[model samples]
Target chain A: MQIVREQDVVPFRNRVKEFATKIGMSLVNQTKLITAASELVRNMLKYANGGKILLEIISKNAQTGVRLTFIDEGPGITDIKQAMQDGFSTGKSLGLGLPGAKRLVNEFDLKSKPGEGTTVTVTHWKNGR
Target chain B: MDRIPILKMGQFLLVTIQVDLYDRLALNLENDLINMVSKTGARGVLIDISAVSIVDSFMGRILGNIASMSRIMDAETVVVGMQPAVAITLVELGLTLQGVYTALDVEKGMELLHDKIGTIEHPEDEEEEAPHDDID
Candidate 1:
């Protein structure tokens, strides 16, 4: 668990980089996860109080990948389902936040409760090798 | 660094965009770059990344968008002066850029400009996106 903020993005990205490196994560995949995490963490700081993110390596039967869980105790999403749409956003972006991140990672799961907290999980694996 | 000004030779306009291009700024810069390519009347654009420590996934997305919009705008976007460290970092970051022309320096950028320079018209319009307050 780590507090989230704009300044924390660097550390979060670095954390992902360190973990991703040990996992032999591909360059493209690593960048995607880092970028996605950075954006989410930024949101956590901008919209919520500090949040914590957990980065871990997961290995399944004959397969290995990285798992990142970002949790924020901020005002939760107004709509979980609509937030997944590309053009839907409560922020000033092109509404590419959640959906764009989804395009980059293998598994994406998110839950949010208004006035409570928000959590997003994304996992990236090697090329099915 | 002082902002690089857009230059005009005959009808062709060559503009330079050199931002650190990191973090979330990378994504917005990409969108701006793409829109500049599509809507601007310029014939050629030279993007210098020497100041950038690295180009990441967000930057990669922008580069792809620029290439796609270049075709739509009937213009050529040449990427210039990517530092070795930046290139390495970009590779390590696993970023990918497609359909972009690259040059080593302004001279080389000019050389690439020679082909499309003659097709340039007046600087027809500026970007339409809401200006990012941080970028000046």
Candidate 2:
């Protein structure tokens, strides 16, 4: 999915919700997944001007999880460590986008290169393992 | 181009967010709501968000901003009908919505507004005189 504007956020969230529901994720877990996705998508738009999101469902034995990867080709983060800290935003936002999204999911991974682009991948398990 | 309507009830402003608000719509609502409060001198502002399911950090900030702005303008803002899932997500997102009053439902929100601002005077009621025959 391509996220190029603010209007794209709602439809993307609805798609994620549908995917999560298909896997029988709980309401709370579904909300968390959708919220985390919202933060990451907004960040991509704000910093990178737009991005591509990949939604995948992974299974480990009998457990199932939803994974979302956000890829942006805009200006990459020079200091990922600082970016992960709470209240550390280059924009006028509250700076909870990155770290807050991490707290809501089971797994979080971020990769960025200066003068290149950024990629953020997150996963939420149905059973919250 | 989509806009959320802000309704005025007596001395209060009511906003029931019935759609999944995009960022622009949310921002527009914040701007329009403050203007309405300032223009009408409304004593209280009730926001019913029962239909909204997802509230990320941006949405959270908008709500907080509305409350703070309304307070400075002498209007109390109450956010009501937050879903349980949304509440949990908000707390985890580090947005506690400080200084913003909240209620479980619209009716309770109205009661809280009345409590905060005292008895409300309906503009329509003031147009007609109540029978004074029983008074003294």
Candidate 3:
């Protein structure tokens, strides 16, 4: 899904919720996943001027998880570590988007190059460990 | 431009959010509600969010901002009917919504608002009123 404007955020969230529900994710887990997706989608729109999101469902053994990858080609983060820290924001926000998103998912990965772009991938397991 | 309606009931303003709020709509609500409070001189604000399914940090901040703004305007804000899942997600998102009041439902929220403003008349007290008081 391409998230290029503020209006796109809601549809992106609905898509994420649909995917999470398809996997029979618990309400709590689904909410967490969707909230994390909302934060990332808004971040992309805020700092990166919008981006594309990829959703996938993966399973291993008896556990199923939903994974989302947000790819943005706008301004990238120079210091990913600082971006992941709480109370750090370049925008006029509460500075909880990145770190808060990380806490909601089971796995979080971020890659950014100052001139290239930024990509964030988050995964939430059905029955979280 | 879609807008959320803010109902004025006596000294209180009521907002029932029945749709999934996009960022823009949420911001607009924050703006409109604050303006309404100031315009009407409302003493309390009640937001019923039972239909809302998810709340991220931005939305959470918006709610907190509304509470803070209303506080400065001398109006108490109560967020009612938060879904259990949304509440859990909010905490995980590191948004405790401090300084905001919350209740389980709209009725309870209305009661809380009345209690906060000291306007609720007991049922027994109403029953004890003399019949001559109804002449007006």
Choose the strongest candidate by DockQ. Answer: 3
TM-score per candidate: 0.59, 0.93, 0.93
Q: Considering only the true interface residues, what is the Cα RMSD of candidate 3 after superposition?
A: 0.7
For candidate 2, state the interface root-mean-square deviation in angstroms to 1 decimal: 0.6
Candidate 1 per-residue lDDT, tens place, B1-136, comes to 2233555554344545554433455555555555555555666767666564335444565766676676577767788887664565454334445578888987787677765555433343334344547856
Q: Over the stretch A1-129, how does candidate 1's per-residue lDDT look in tens digits?
A: 576444566656778888888878776566666766665665677678678888888988767888888888889898888987756768655465677677667888999989899988888886523
RMSD of each: 11.8, 6.8, 6.1
**Residue pairs with clashing backbones, model 2:** none
Task: Choose the strongest candidate by lDDT.
Answer: 2
The C-alpha lDDT values of all candidates are 0.66, 0.94, 0.92
List where candidate 2 sits over 4 angstroms from the true fold.
Answer: B120-136
Superposition error at B76 for model 3 (Å) = 0.4
DockQ of 2: 0.72
Give the distance in Å from residue A70's predicted Cα in candidate 3 to where it truly belongs: 0.3
Please state the i-RMS of candidate 1: 6.2
lDDT for each residue of candidate 2 in A1-129, tens digit (9 for 90 to 100) = 999998899999999998899899999999999999999999999989999999998998889999999999989999999999999999999999999999999999999998789999999999776
lDDT of 3 by residue, B73-103 (tens): 9999999999999998888888999999999
Query: Can you give the DockQ of every candidate in the order shown?
Result: 0.07, 0.72, 0.75
Model 3 Cα shift for residue B21 (angstroms): 0.8
